[model samples]
Target: MVDSAIITDNSEVLLHFDLKLEDGSAADSTRVHNKPAKLVMGDGSLTPNFESCLRGLKAGDKKTFTLPPDDAFGMPNPDNIHHMERSKFNLDAPAEVGMIIGFTQPGGMEIPGIIRAVAGDSVTVDFNHPLAGETVVFSVEILKVK
Candidate 1:
């Protein structure tokens, strides 16, 4: 039996997690050597289905589940790729392949874009998350329930 109220909307939880891809490739894992991640439920930071899986789980509970791309980061959008003049970037920054750069948005929010390619004067950046279209497997161990 577990305390249902231990896991509720807005509750804070500490969990050690491992995120894997469909090919059994390890994408990210806190279990390797990192502190547990702290997240507040229903904060829009987590997908509804992910949060649903945590519901009714208490401290010391462990679970593993897979989330489809749509439920995780959602599929990548073609529109997220944009080509801009190399001059638009700071020369000191030095555009390189696979480098993530932060671009300021109209709303003052910084969006991270990965450098996909660079030509003589044009640079292609992709705003989609690296894991956007990948189905992810999450293995979670609840450390604390608050």
Candidate 2:
């Protein structure tokens, strides 16, 4: 019996990963929360470039790859920034800069948007990903592949 499997286009991969920003600051890490990430290859959740980097990796494999903004989260799009009336925000908890709030889409899906500015009756919300426009370092330790 084979003791291990390599990550393929349809493999289910379980791994611990560290995402670091261009400034060398830790952006996210599965090890920090002690929870490994699980994903099926070819799933739309990961960019094709990211999937390609993991191809053929097996359990116990360790790899680190740098992805530019386009390959990672893509650059921030101006269209993703929106300005809304201040009344739309909850009065109980006033919206402030750097606050992330969930906004429901037309399809009932919720997406997180960060408050960028609040001026009078106008509030600016950025829907771009937090790491958008930034290059990132992805360090992964493959735990299991099936």
Give each model's whole-structure lDDT: 0.89, 0.92
- Candidate 1 achieves a global lDDT of 0.89
Give per-model TM-scores.
0.88, 0.95
lDDT accuracy of residue 132 in candidate 1: 96
In Å, residue 46's CA in model 1 sits off its true spot by 1.4
Candidate 2: Cα lDDT at 87: 93
- Kindly provide the TM-score of model 1 when superposed on the true structure, using C-alpha atoms: 0.88
lDDT of 1 by residue, 1-146 (tens): 55444788899998998889988999988777877889999988678988998888889899999899988888999999999999898868888989999999999999999999999999999999889998999889998888
